[model samples]
Target: MSVPPENLHPRSRLVHDALRAAGILGEIVVLPDAASTAALAAAALGIEVGAIANSLVFWSDDEPLLVMTSGAHRVDTAALAERLGRGRISRASVEQVREATGQAIGGVAPTGHPAPIVTVVDEDLAAFDQIWAAGGTPHTVFPLTYDELVRLTGGTVAKVD
Candidate 1:
């Protein structure tokens, strides 16, 4: 059985409050684990892999770039670096991740960063009717339509593969 929506983790509660303040209406749901992988999350939620919105933070030189990618495609780091006109692209360290996004590794949400971040939404994600994104916790997720995500994050739609 799943926990009630009102009984959310603190991080997820923060996410919910932030989303609402941003004028976004979505429902947050929590699971049992950090769910570091989209496959694991999809399996647990019984949703298609394509519906999982994997929030990935990449270190683009000295800046942090957030990519909301679909579980179906792998991000090409080198290509993305070239596309972004960055010298190099690398995964962010745990500290860097926390500092940049104001959230821990597995719980990072697309919004609610202490500062603004350049965001990119994978074009592949548009194929899904609804996508599940991290709710500031590894085990928490929220439902969003593809267009809503693009609008909410002010994200550029790109072919992230």
Candidate 2:
């Protein structure tokens, strides 16, 4: 069973608000257990792991770049940086993740950040009709289409791996 939106964690409530503001119709679903990793989320939802959209933060030229990638593949940061014509891309630290997104590492949502982040949507995610993304908490997730995700995050669609 899913909890009411008002009863969600404060961080999740921010995500819920962001989704509503974006006109996304999907409701956040609170899982029975924490789905911190893509594999765990896929198993919990009984969906293909590739359908899980992992929200990852990377530091590029000392700025935060949000990369939403399919769970089935690892992001090739070097190739991605070259494609973006940016400097080296490195994973953000835990503190940096929270400072930039106002959420923890395992539960970073595409939206609801303290400020706008430069975002990239993996081209592979478009293969799935429905994609699941974290809802600002380990126990929460929401559904979205690849187009909706790109629009929501103002992301550039690219091959991330």
Candidate 3:
């Protein structure tokens, strides 16, 4: 059974409100189980794993970088840093993830953070007409198109892997 937006976790409600404010028509779908991983989310949604937009937070010179990568690919931090003209990119600590996104690692949404994060949307995700993204909680997700995601997060489109 899917949980309605009004019944969502507080964090998920924040994401729902953000989506509405942005004029996105999609509603958050709460999974029966926590879909923390892309594979898990794909299986739950009955969609291709590539359609899952994994929200990853990285540390670039002490700044937080949010990379929305396709589930079908693995992000190469070194290559990404070189492509972005950055020195190094490392996975953010759990604390940093929470502080930066105001959500847990496995449930970070592209928007609805305490502040705007520097985000990069994977170019490969544009191949999909619709994509699923985390909804501020492990058990919640939402759908949107690639263009909508880029606009929502104000992210740069790049080949993340």
Candidate 4:
């Protein structure tokens, strides 16, 4: 038999409240920590990988850049830097991520960051009717439409991946 989720984590609860406050009405799905990856999440939810919105954080010089990429593609950091006219683009460290977004590695949602970080949404993600995203916790995720995500996050839709 499958195990039920333990939905008491502070981070997860914060995500729930944040989403609700943003007028994002959707059910939260909690899984094991190992299921945080897009592939793993899709398999556990029995959904297509393309529907997973992978929240990726990058360091553009000293600033934080959030890129919500589709699960089906890999983000080309060099290409993104070129497009943004930035010095460089690289993956953020755990400390950098936490300091910038007030969230951890596997649970960085589009919103609820400590401050307003520049966010870019991959255009490929627009192909999905609905997408799943991290909910401030590795085991938690929430659903949102592409347009809703853009509105809630104030993110620009671009070809980042």
Candidate 5:
């Protein structure tokens, strides 16, 4: 049996609420071990790594940019910067990540932030029928479709490779 959403951790509960408000009913799954990385999450769920949606936080022009990239691929910052017409794209610091996302580095979800953040969804993620993303914590995750992800984050879909 699954635990009630109210019984989840505060962070995860917020995420659950956010997802629920967005019409997403996927139950958040908690792993015995920390699934901080996409590879670990995929292995724990017995899914292909490519199907994991890695939520990477980046900073460009002092703004938070969330990139939902495929786990199997790395975001080419330089190329992505050019494509997005941003000046240099750099990884956000741990403090910055937490401030912008209200979650740790290894477990930042697409939504559930203090404010609406600018997001970009990788085109490669659309290849998978289902994509698993962090659920506001290192040990929790939830599944959703590409369209759902795009709609949830209101992210612009682009090639991130």
Candidate 6:
């Protein structure tokens, strides 16, 4: 169900507020069931898995790298690193993810992080007119256009897989 900003989970509220501050009007929606995975989120939303923008955090050169990748594919760290001209990028540990994003592992959003993260938007996500992303929790999600996601995160568009 759609949740107004005041009624959102604390973490989700952060996302809601962030979205509002960024001039986004889409309200956060809570799923009846937790959708910790992209496949599950797609099933619940009745959308193609490719339309789900998976918020992934990767550790690169001792910094947090936020990758908004398409749910249908996996991130190729080696290629990504080479493309980004960075050192090896590895999946951040749960604790690291939490520390970097101030949110949990299962439902991290691209925005509302403790600090601005170097973000990458998967070019594949642009194929969808609308994309869904986690709203700071596994049971929450929000919708926006591909351009909005890029603007929200100030993410560099690139091929992630």
Per lDDT, the best of the predicted structures is: 2
Give TM-scores for every candidate, taking all chains together and pairing residue i with residue i. 0.90, 0.98, 0.97, 0.89, 0.98, 0.98
> Over the stretch 50-78, how does candidate 3's per-residue lDDT look in tens digits?
99999999999779999999999999999
Q: After best superposition, candidate 4 residue 81: deviation in angstroms?
A: 1.3
Per-candidate count of clashing residue pairs (backbone under 3 Å): 0, 0, 0, 0, 0, 0
TM-score (C-alpha) between model 2 and the true structure: 0.98
For every candidate in turn, the CA RMSD to the true structure comes to 1.9, 0.6, 0.9, 2.9, 0.9, 0.6
lDDT of 1 at 50: 89
lDDT of 6 by residue, 1-161 (tens): 99778899899999998999999988899999999899999999999999999999999999999999999989999999999999999999999999999888779988888789999999999999999999999999999999999999999999999
User: Scored by CA lDDT, what does every candidate get?
Assistant: 0.83, 0.95, 0.93, 0.81, 0.94, 0.94
Q: Candidate 6, which segments miss by more than 4 Å at Cα?
A: none
State, as a TM-score between 0 and 1, how close model 6 is to the true structure.
0.98
Least well predicted 10-residue stretch by lDDT in candidate 1: 1-10
lDDT of 6 at 134: 95
Q: 57-135 in candidate 5: lDDT tens per residue?
A: 9999889899999999999999999999999999999999999999998999998999999999999999999999999
Select the stronger candidate by lDDT from 2 and 5: 2
The residue ranges of model 5 lying beyond 4 angstroms of the native Cα positions read none
Give the alpha carbon lDDT tens digit for every residue of 55-119 in model 1. Answer: 99988867988999998878998887777677787888899889988888877888777887888
Q: What lDDT score goes with residue 93 in model 4?
A: 92
Residue 159 C-alpha lDDT in model 6: 97
